[model samples]
Target chain A: MAGSNHTPIKPVHRARLDNIAVVLHRPHFPENIGAVARACKNMGIFHLIVVDPLDCDLTRILKMATHASEDVVANMEVYDDLAEALGPFNYIVGTTARRGSQRRTVMNPREVARELIPISQNNRIALLFGPENRGLANRELKLCHTLVTIPTSEFASLNLAQAVMIMLYEIFTASAEFPPDFVPRLASSFELEAMYDHLSRTLAKIHFINPENPEYWMMNIRRFFSRMQLRARDVKIIRGICRQIEWYCEERVERLLREAGVNRVDPEGDCEDRFFGGE
Target chain B: MAGSNHTPIKPVHRARLDNIAVVLHRPHFPENIGAVARACKNMGIFHLIVVDPLDCDLTRILKMATHASEDVVANMEVYDDLAEALGPFNYIVGTTARRGSQRRTVMNPREVARELIPISQNNRIALLFGPENRGLANRELKLCHTLVTIPTSEFASLNLAQAVMIMLYEIFTASAEFPPDFVPRLASSFELEAMYDHLSRTLAKIHFINPENPEYWMMNIRRFFSRMQLRARDVKIIRGICRQIEWYCEERVERLLREAGVNRVDPEGDCEDRFFGGE
Candidate 1:
């Protein structure tokens, strides 16, 4: 068995972890800093940024990091300002334990993880964790485009390293195995608007819609279709049906006028004027 | 508006949070213990347990905990053993950052939060956290009926206090506003089986089931029905339809046999035997 010549093949590179940076903003403890570095190593994330860190011992950081993650500790970057630290990254996510009335709704780690995969493909992403004592300052949080909160019991005071681990875990799990893309691209707003306009005019010409209360009924129809994530092809098909119906009804009206043998011009199918408040 | 006498009415008692305990096993630092207590207070959890903690300063714990969480720190209980600490609790959840081959798949915090709401209604539940150096021991993990791991990158190290806070935050958010219950109580397994037996016999009597491979078809039918969360009322209605179909078919068979003039002894019509394999 020892002499067996079987070699295990290395996994093909996905490089999801390569573009991610774990940024600890104003970390208080040296040991916490070391733990963050170890966690980054565990998750295959090499870049670590400690912003405006407290005066801490590198020995304490390395001790907690152990030999396995010493490479991460050795290559860690330090910055004086949050903006400078985040300048290289395109996508930024801030983690906070507290909620406020003015703050945007936060995504849970799992949701963020799945979302970051596509973002990480072409751009550098930063995951920001705040200090142990009070979490990120409001000014620092303002720089982030999105926020992530770990769901906890009523007492949401988690240690800094734990928060870092949760975020990394989610991103790793999401990146490791991608889910099948079942969601199709939806129609753009312009296409949907054109379809709606065609439908409204067709209905009015056929007198299926009441000109007096067209707004109310049209609004209801818009609501119904908006709920269905219609595709571009679906919008075009619907518009085509509306045009056919309009043509069919108008042709029938012209044939009926000719049978009557009247000299007057056929009734104008422009009942569309009534819908637009006699425009 | 200030002088108006419109005092807000408080919600009625739904003391789900009161029944939960956050247990920390052999927590290394005293400050983390204080932070966890503060988190419990933030989430409305009153009970806390620390098992054989490391020698640490209580002042540091309280100082970090602040004044609002003083009650949590003062009332914290210490235990030498995990089982003794969890004796009063009916449900146990252990938190781990690392997944092992021996460990079961862990629930993400949000999923656990929704699940725990109904559990916390009448049962005493505990959320257990491990020590700072390495997390929970395997022996301690064995005592848990369920495990929760914060999704992290390959590097899964998180600070103990942070882990506690994330867990508490989830429970708190889930408990703060209850989602409207849309799921009805499902029919018990026994009720469902009885309905299936009746249905199979009816199908056999009506000549819809093939005699040679009746089990193969019946198994597929059973699989379809098991997927639906049928209620007791739904089972009753389905059974009624099966009975009616059996009666109509049996009556039609008797009329046909009488006209054929070959019914000196009526065909005993034992369709049950075909379904039950000669029951």
Candidate 2:
């Protein structure tokens, strides 16, 4: 296969570090925030988003961040809500030290970085970190499509800044080369949440799932669908099916009432209240 | 090729992180020393040597190092001279943020880490870091056998502790034994087919798909689920939903039939044959 005339072709697309936004959720320390900025700049990731920081003292953050990363700190976006902060990102990777049955499908930083190469080219990616003390809670983790755990020794506790540094380091290193496979743009977290909400309501109406504990049952459905890495079109297709189910159920109910010659005061209102209320 | 008896042999030798020593030369702050200690402990590197630190305030260092890393601080070695501090080390890897003609042969942290793994097994390796303000000078870098430079953006400056963290992280990750990626077994073709058949029948009953073109509509669903590589448990969940839909539709029809009191021969039979005939 080795021919003297052979010339290596350059990859058309490479991992876009610019597309990556480092999201720090509820960081307790301003110093860590500054250090995280420094780490972000060092790794060529410019976008930094801080969600509900306990302390937003510029002096303390700048002291650790140094002057080089001032631009990152200056350009940083602050948000009060994690959901709104993650709304624009197409893919979110949550960092966690603790592993559980719910977070079984975790990838190490290196593995995730490699997997993200193709995805970063087409979709905006978010590297989410929880507060310094406790990591991303289960509720917060629900928003993340993928989970990343940094492998460590028995002494597994890593400083918030250190965790950010290692993760960015892996991504920066991996971004040097391009993989052949290309992942197309996936549905944004906003779109996906909307689809899931609609699906939950539809499934609940059909009595396919218990509305009292929808999230419990919905978690499995979320995992199954997340595995598909649904695009915007896929979300639309699923929502379409949910709509059809709603329509079919209501039409069948109306037809049954009409065929019975029941003198119900308002058949449409009764069925609408039961199935399509609060829409 | 058909041999059934083959036993895998474990490697006889592996990298020993214990043989590595982190040497900080003329570090400016005690907090960085403490943070470096923490980084070292996090990655399983125990030996730490500080040569002529600007201030060796134990309290300030410990404050940053935290209680988890007290042992590392307790056992840390302090020296007045850099040469004396690195006397016992056989191989030295100097970390520098600046590049010069003399240090042209610089390897990124990841590359250097891989190279050090084998050497770390038999020889004492020293990872040298200079002051926070200025990196290892030419005179100091002369003592190092290899030079490592953490790749950075235009803002190449990295905190002293952060630099130490990245270097140690690379070495720790390179030395660790990683198994192949964990991929849980997927649902067998038979299980997937059964779930698909159930789903097709359910969708047809709901009028979500035309009965005449059920296969055409299901092709899209099949492709979506195929991407997920559904596990056996996931397949079961989908089938359960199908069964629930069938039950809900039959129950609703029977309730409507009873409420209207129109003499339909058998409501259950009518709905069952229409929605759940094959099953």
Which residue runs of candidate 1 sit more than 4 Å off their true CA positions?
Answer: A1-15, A42-44, A63-68, A95-114, A129-142, A147-159, A173-279, B1-15, B42-44, B63-68, B96-111, B131-139, B149-159, B173-279
lDDT of 2 by residue, B6-121 (tens): 75555544358899999999999999999998998898989999999999999999988989899999999999999988989999999888776683699988788889878987
Candidate 1 local lDDT, B62-118, one digit each (tens): 976777788888898989987778766656778887765432546777667777776
Q: Which of the numbered candidates is closest to the native, going by highest lDDT?
A: 2
Instruction: Report the C-alpha lDDT of model 1 over A86-168, residue by residue, as the tens digit.
Output: 99999999999877633597888878888887788899999999888898888888889789887765557666776786677
Give the Å shift of residue A37 in candidate 1.
2.5
RMSD, one per candidate, in order: 20.4, 4.8
The TM-score values for the models, in the order shown, are 0.51, 0.91
Best by DockQ: 2
- In terms of lDDT, model 2 sits at 0.82
* lDDT digits (tens) for residues A1-279 of candidate 2: 576359776554446899999999999999999999999989899999999999999999999888889999999999999999999999999999886656458888988888888889889999999998888998888888889888877887899999999999888877534454777789999999999999898777766666677787677678777666789888888887787666655566666656666544333331212221111
Query: DockQ (Cα-based) per candidate?
Result: 0.10, 0.42
Q: What is the interface RMSD of candidate 1, in Å?
A: 20.7
